[model samples]
Target chain A: MGAGVTVDRLAELLVSHFGAPADRVAGGVTFEELEFDSLALVELAMVAQKEFGVEVDEQEFTPEQSVAGAARLIDSRRAAS
Target chain B: MPQAMPGFGVAVTGLGLVTPAGIGVDEVWRRVLSGEPTAAPDPALEGMPVDFSCRVPGFDPDRELGRRAAWRLDRSSQLAVVALREALRDSGLDPSTWDGARVGVVIGTALGGVQTYEAQQRELDSSGVGAVSPLLVPMSAPNMVAGYLAMECGASGPNLVTATACASGATAIGTARELLRGGRCDVVITGGVDAPITRTMIAGFTRMGALSRRTSDPRAASRPFDTARDGFVAGEGAAVLVLERNHDARVRGARVHGLISGYGASADAHHATTPDPSGAAAERAVRSALEDAGLSAHDVDHVNAHGTSTKLNDVTEARLVRGVFGDGVAVTSTKGVTGHALGAAGAIEAVCTLLALRDDVVPPTANLDSLDPEVEVDVVAKEPRPGRLRAAVSNSFGFGGQNAVLVVTRS
Candidate 1:
């Protein structure tokens, strides 16, 4: 909430940038469930950094993290900075 | 002459092209027949010694391929993917239902992902290592185009990339034919792609004096075999062909566009960038191809010469053709229209040869108002030539002394 990095926005980003199916991108959907490989996750992290202006360690962002979880992590990182 | 070479041919079922002339096979063929040059002022090559180049116009990769997929691939691979889609679609083969293991993919590229490599190197230099994408290796490697096509179509059989510099495309097709003749695969998605219009590649070619410096009139730059020809114009594009054994194609009821009756590949062991002045190795390749087809040179109605518009290549290739075909065969260099696509040139020309065979018309070489006096061949120029083009030879000679020739016959 601090950075306004909502789960909906994250989902939209995933769909747009990762070519994830629009219907498959949801708040509860995990990165693993979306078939985001390690490379894809790293790319997502870089994209997130560029779009959200937050420094999120790519390694810390695991495939098991859900869309909502990623939004929360981004919010926390934004707040910390 | 030998009656017919047993088991030395493969059926070309479908073709796709994204060249400077246009996208798709029909569009490019139309432009090539019209003898319109595709070279123009390239903003990317601005301030360089040879500033103009032939680029694939209206190629919005993000729109053609989904943004996500396009973002992950280099422009070279993107061109391959787009061309592969068209080829597969035209073949009436559905990858979703096909046996993936029975399919193969072979791609050829001289400078793979050079644009991507240059850009990523700049990023690393300016923003440090962390700014570089993890996809750099996958995007820049020469083998990745084959890998990408395999992934796209779920092809699991014998996938590899052939690099014979400018002859890479013909080499790929030749290799794919072997796979089929060897019973390794039922079908193969094979061809070449190169996006070499980047600043670094152009600068390198400029330094080598391998490119035409026709800054005043870019469109008239790629005049293969013309008396005024200097050097080749740099171009970027891709071409993919779906190949299968003739029997397999017939059994599956697939339309056979043409047959690759013979393929001959050789190396001069001569020089890195210069062809042998005598053109002996090139002649050997052509002779070998004709021998493999179990036919003599007289059977070849047309010669798709490797006329790169350069003084050396045009004269060498023209002499080779004259010695073999004796000025009786029709000769044309579609490179005049599409420019020199480097690795992709062979594949593009192969497709053009097939189209010419299919339509019984030889496309004219663009801007060849006056043939070079040293060139003693019947070079088709100005307008398309209509004839019984039952068979043709598509020649591709690359740097590093690589030579590959394919004898294509009408289906």
Candidate 2:
């Protein structure tokens, strides 16, 4: 994950991955609220890792978390690196 | 041999056909009875080893099925859905009044959505992964047709897809009949669909020497029982039948199209692609279907032969017919007119069988100029043969030595 990656960028990434309507892509919206299944989460993680070089462990993430929550975790991992 | 597992006596009330000959029951039957080969040069398949194929002419899925539904389904699934809609309408059943949960759907298909798979792969190559439609899995899965059919008819009782190569459709219908006899549902939508005219499949089948290469003469390519018969012409389409309890149909005063008195299936267990030339298992299938129907071989007046026009299938099926029904029974291969529709062959032939029983006419084997000396059976040719048909059997033998036979008696 890059330090420059922000909450809005993370939410936009998920919205694009899911083909969700742009208006529905709120940063605090949970994956479950966004109507994404486990497969969708796995795919989003795959694309995120491929693009930003950050690993998203499936066990560490939950559908309850919002896109901002995931973005913060990515920022923390990058800061540590 | 699986014994005749007849359940409560199932009756076919409606039939839907989307074939190379044409769409709808009457149109396809008329074309088939005309003894005109439906195979034509597929411009989309030009330059391929076997460019000509038997395509469902004038098929507009967007028009037949609405835009949303057509977008959500593969071509195979589209064909199934369209045929299913037609069959349900033909059956005169009020779906809104019926119990959707009690209905069942079983479809037979070999390559479910290979066409979709091919197109998506091309898209993935040209564009990025993001360009792929989210419904690809649902659209392309082999069982998706059954799933979509369930969605269409609200069939929740027992829905499944059988993939027994060429024998798939017949197997699905037989399996559905058994489920009905077992009291699984009040009605079942059963049939098969296939669209295998893609370049890769054509090339693969061509390499296996399974497709006819008589591109110059598309009309004469599928010459079943003829000495010049080389291979089967690849065809695409779907056929569906609405089957219900015979007693219930009678009580409702429904117009019974035909009675599925018997269903028999067996395996050669010999080879994967090549059938056993001895025709033992295939012979058993016919005998078992007859036994299951509670009818003797002499009762069957017409035989819808699976004469694929291939070197082995025609001769082997001819011998099987002779061995089972003796030499007097009328036999004709509808494949000679519609080409080989793969998984849907049996279901389409089943429709043809019912039509033959109703009209008392055996559709001719198209393009049979000279019957092979090796074939001793009476293969109908030239024009439709009008006869007194009390009972008929449709035989389907697939790549894995699978054999299935369905016996239908006059309604």
Candidate 3:
């Protein structure tokens, strides 16, 4: 949230924290495309809150959303707050 | 109908052990042969009443299992999956080519993913319900040990977890025999696993006075059948055996490690935690197992007593063995070397029995300085005894008065 919450920063978090394959964690790939299940998404939500200090609803963090899209949402939420 | 091969018991084609003694069948057997106790002080139990335990040495989940898989599974399931892979490979059965529906999985566990449950409960208490893991139920459920193994091996047949306390493993093996005999499946992957060394679990057992508190000398804590023995040392591990009908194993040209000739189970109907002092119901299971194998007392060569190192269990088990097999049969408790693996104890002992049959050598019960005068059975101690061991019985009695006995024969 402080620095812009870049797509690259989000990708690093997924790969390092979530055991997501490095090759598969790209900006254009949707979470569903990356095979992140519902349970994983919920866990990701909790991790994101702690890491970025921004509240993200697990339900709203849709599987169809791409990693880049997620970064933009976090950045927008930070600006609005 | 499943073809019945009368007088021919199910073949134990393969065995996989991840135990406190060491990992894999050969490593654990080697350590057991040396009579080296694996118990030591645990940093996690630093402040507890009993600060030591027997842990599976050098078990790295992230390295043994991939980070992706290990992160999702509980410690118990991780152990089961690793052991299962070994078992399947040893059985010479390729899951990719085998009929998935014809393979079954049965796991026995006294406590399943208890560490995970405790951690999640702590998270809930401190960080509210929202912070709790969504994977908690699937990861910590008592049935997930078998469920995860089934998923790992693509086994679609009968899959369930048996939870009869300490007798769970023996009960699982017996139930797997029934599945094979009833033609439920041609191959059954069955065993027991438990990682119950959490602070809460150790504390609970400590409260029950079920653990050995010889903190000064951790290695000498689990002294089965010895007069100076106090109680069992809590441990964690897993053992899996691939079971197939004798004819099926022969047809496939699988290497038969041994045969689970007979299995018997009974309830004491006596007490919750205390084994029947009379050893009545426990004897019934032993006699029934021998009878089921069409074997008499004189036919058995050795006895792998449950021998938990606890006074009640060791004394009662010794009396039962002496009552059933007289004075000449060789007896030993591997628990003295590996510590008490609780739910995994039965299966681990069964594998040891098979190895004993294979090599015709009975490993000594570690830390048995002086045998109890009341225990009249011939307990092999001090060193491993080399002899002709044809058939051996492994006994497992659990809390809630549950007793399970298995009769294993050299193939």
Candidate 4:
């Protein structure tokens, strides 16, 4: 966990991990809006674990959540650590 | 209305394989004959819920097929392409000369693109649907293996995929054999490919308690028909065989590996996952295969058992083997060495058994330290046994009570 992680970095990581476009994962874009299925979510979690050294439990997140919301949660966890 | 007898028999002209043992049919056969076990404790899976798995070693599809092509294909499809290419090469079937509509492709897979699906799930959870790749749906589909193979080899008669859990591979071959026998296709590339060794699949199996937990002794973990066996070790690989009508093969002057004498498929309809403990369904499947071959159980010289290494499967299969082949048949479960390749297990073992007939040897069942007392059949263990194998029967039983048996003999 680190404070240096930016929204841009998060978007890039999402694109790199999911093979999606960065603009499609913007602040207001929800998981469902982007058509992110369960399989895509798991890939995102694995990439997050590898890159950010954080484990994102599948039970904690939902399709209703926005990409910005997930980034904020990761940022807050980084701050707490 | 009476159906006319089948026109022609299916002959295996060439074979290909990509397994934990090695790549290509020759390499896989050599390793099987040497009694080698490919199960190993992977530290990458150390903290994971599933402790043991039979992973293909040093298989980098990108290195083999280039990055762009590898990216488009799942691990299972990659394995299938490699195997299919080898089989086509071995058969000397010039794709340029063959009639695409007269050739067929059938592939069986228990879990296809599971790894890709899992990866996509991670993306969906973190980002959203926009992150999902357009190729996700096609790549994750089980039939895509056959689709890819058909496209690669120009097989257009019947492109099909069978997904009967573990029996999928054998069922695929059986379907292809029927297609050939009915005079629907002259050549059919048929087999099984599975790469279900994903984190989620392992976790699910771990939760189900269907995987071995002996992480320290990987080689000794998968002891099929042995008293110490607990459960099967998950494996990933692919095996494909080129089947042609005997007349077509003769006309082409192709070297015939063996004849697919008969195939019998049955369903227990009793359970979704666990097999029928009575062994009636499995016995019927074996007997039907023998009958279809116009041979009795006595005609069978070697048996390639399903042998999942699970306690219940071992007992039920042993009873079925005894009921079919009696006490004297030389039987071996190659899953002891190859582990269970899920959908690909039966097809790969079928090919192995075919090779045993071709080479006149019984491939040994590795890691069987002590025979389960309840298993009345003769289980080949340790070193490969020399034998005059004329006709061999391979059994593949899967979840949802699906059972398939294939009888193959020397040409």
Candidate 5:
């Protein structure tokens, strides 16, 4: 599941889940720009868990953080495991 | 005991309600007093497993707010925004005159945007992410109501959303009171809104056996405190109240409808979905509210009960009411008409209680032909009960054993 989920797919999921425009949701966009509140972050984590089989902790995600950071973290975790 | 803070009383200056009973405060009161059950098998929910739901009548938020804005918001958020707009307008507080930093918004919701989430999920599953709407994420979060209200009203203070199930609304109002009492805000728009009558939500509640199966007779389905009651009917709505500090209201020459004198909240830490039959925690919540108001059981003349019409909730809430106000005080469950509004129940019931205090009339618990023998409270039924109501208590007990009680009195 980890190998199957790429940065582009994560970006797509972010765009879909956060309802942000796809162009604005690339690796550079912050969660705050997408209006991702705590509840949405929790739901996004659930979606990530269901789609990628990777349980993402909501607390670990920062609103100021970009999608690329999440992708890098997921990739690093997958490689380490 | 610690000395009571000076200028701590918070008065509800304006109220806005969007319920199955009706939209706006007066309309809701009118329908509630008429004892008309608004529960009906929604055609929108035809394919869903749960048959009966209490949907708001003629609710077109776009009529009040613009269509483009309504399109981006979920029903829950739309309800909150519209209700808050009415509440602010009723309060006569021009947002332009107030410091945005001193105004706050707190809204409570139970399931957030289950409908929007479900719709987006269907799209994601069927047509992939490209088919999902752009507003799906912002519209689905529970806190979006609070965020939207704050943005709409230009409130910059501590904006929050409480999700304590049914108690969420009362809790939101209680939080507003604290914020005003602490001098953090001069005015706070607080309440609860929920639009959870979605196919997935109805199916979930039905699967859990929490919804009434009396689809043929929706009006007779939600019989709170009645012996024939099976389970609660799902309802969608929101209620908002504008709360200001007593001194601030007086300074601004605002009409104070009623004072939110006290609020008490407690968690049973019991079952997630069932209440403690002993009703110990709920009793504590009621007692604590009374104590906070510097009153006794004798002072409360009316009670807005959290009678969900479920077998356990009705019995347990009745026992708690008896324990707090004794069998003498008049008790009524608005859910009999509103059909268990989940998270918005407390706030909507609180508004009803405030109106009852204002009008000196208690709305009846509709459809209660025969009272449950296990519940001994004086359940007001059939018609509105006229009385000299000075102080009224509204109880909201949610799932997760969360209990909140609010005491409102004539200003």
Candidate 6:
């Protein structure tokens, strides 16, 4: 798989960034379900970078709509690197 | 291509103001026209050399803006958001039907997010670097004001901020006016905000000889054009205006306040803090604004002067008003009442100018008991003066020798 990325790993990172219940941060969960906004997405990006050692291309990825979308963005960036 | 007309007019449909005088536009107008002092002793600065500063008293952020937003934003941004909400409501442009992609935002702030930066620094100094808020960079940047507006308004066209010290507000308005004239956007929210009554700023202005030291009598300290005037009083506030094409406002049957007919911007290249004593660049700013409005000196009847109570600013601005509009024009400086609001001064004065043109009354310069012997301009004093206002000018001169003058006409 690209960057050896997995949903389980990305979901764990999301739990800490949003302070959400660990079980709720799953591949199918959306950012809106936890009420994350643009600022939260920014913080998420920072946490993703530290956790996965990936460089996010903002132009290629905007996770304002969903958490699954954000996880995919992080994995793609990790794969690209 | 042919030479286009200088005064490409735009309609001012809505205004939102939060000043030391009051909260809304009507409240400020009534208090301003009736001649009340807004400056008072700020308890926060009780022990400082200059204990008096004009603050927007009783402004409840959590009540006005919801909890999460109010907590995340800096003080300046909170003030701007409240003002913007009012402006949008007053404009009556239903966002559901409006074209968000075509709308633009151009808000101005001098030291944006300084409050956030200072708080984070204190935490870092005490706790550790890790104690600093992760939101520090995104929250403290000056561009964040515009960025937040873009996010809130869903506006995509030319969202930006201008920072030229005190002229930031007027310059932002001028730039927005051009954006509309150039057909870059159909509508724009333009203005400035500043909540800079901090201890560091107070000490800095005092050390630089820019703030009034008359702490014993705060109300009477900001006496523009008075012989006893020493320095400008620091104030905090925000003002925003909704600008649209004249044709669009009429088609929508929106209430039109006045028309922005002209805007002139120039640099003195003389000094950083002090204005050019010769008043050459300042005069040029006035001439250019009048010319851009396609108006002659004789046609102008009212003026909203940037009459900060400082000795140099008052003298220089008075001379230029006399030289450009003549000594007969009714000149008033609301700063005498609301104090100098820095970047927000010009925007607040612009709102006052539109109100004056619409209401046919000129608000008086508070605390101006005795005009300086050397000054010759007709300073409106004590109470409101009513007349047929044909055209008017609002002047804003800031540090870095930046000057911007705006011309408003009754349409």
> How far is B356's C-alpha from truth in model 3 (Å)?
0.8
Local distance difference test scores for all models: 0.91, 0.86, 0.91, 0.84, 0.85, 0.84
Please write out the lDDT profile of model 4 over residues B1-411, one tens digit for every residue.
Answer: 112242234779989999988888888888888778889877657788556788777888967766435767889999999999899999988988889999999899999988889888998899777456556887898889999998887887889899989999999998998888777888899999999887788888888888887777888888899899988999999999999877778887889988888888999989778889998888888888887777888888899999999989989999888987788789999998888999999899889978888999998888888999999999899888997887889999998999999998887
Give the higher-TM-score candidate: 3 or 4.
Answer: 3
Q: Which ten residues in a row have the lowest lDDT in candidate 4 chain B?
A: B1-10
Tell how far residue B336 is off in model 4, in angstroms: 0.9
Root-mean-square deviation of each candidate, in angstroms?
Answer: 2.3, 6.1, 1.5, 7.8, 8.5, 7.2
Candidates' TM-scores? 0.96, 0.84, 0.97, 0.83, 0.83, 0.85
lDDT of candidate 3 over B1-411, digit per residue (tens): 444343448999988999999889999999999999999999999999999999999999988987778878899998888888888889988889889899999889999999899999999999887788888999999999999999898999999899989999999999999899999998999999999999999999999999999999999999999999999999899999999998889998999999999988999999999998999999999998988887898999999999999999998999899999999789999999999888898999999999999999999999999999988899999899999987889999999999999999988
Residue A77 accuracy (lDDT) in model 4? 61
For candidate 1, the TM-score is: 0.96
Give the TM-score comparing model 6 with the true structure, all chains together.
Answer: 0.85
Q: What is the lDDT, from 0 to 100, of the residue A19 in candidate 3?
A: 72
- Which scores higher on TM-score, 1 or 6? 1
Rank order (by TM-score, best first): 3, 1, 6, 2, 4, 5
Comparing 1 with 5 on TM-score, the higher-scoring candidate is: 1
Off by over 4 Å in 6: A1-32, A37-81, B1-4
Candidate 2 wrongly placed segments (more than 4 Å): A1-81, B1-8
Backbone clash pairs in model 5 (N, Cα, C under 3 Å; residues 3+ apart or in different chains), count = 0
Q: Clashing residue pairs, candidate 5?
A: none
Query: DockQ score of candidate 6?
Result: 0.10
Name every residue pair that clashes in candidate 3.
none
Tell me the lDDT of candidate 3: 0.91
Instruction: Give the runs in model 5 whose Cα sits over 4 Å from its true position.
Output: A1-81, B1-8
Per-residue lDDT tens digits for candidate 5, residues B1-411, read 123542245889988888899888889999999889989879888866567789889988667666436667898888878888788889998887789998889888999988889889998999666446656878898888888898887899889999999899999988888888777887899999899988877888888788888877889999999999989999989999999887778888999989999888999988989898888988898888888887888989999999899889999888888877788799999999898888899999999999999999999999999999999889999999998998999999998999999999888
Mark the 10 consecutive residues where model 1 chain B has the least summed lDDT: B1-10
Q: Pick the DockQ winner.
A: 3
Model 5 residue B88 lDDT score: 85
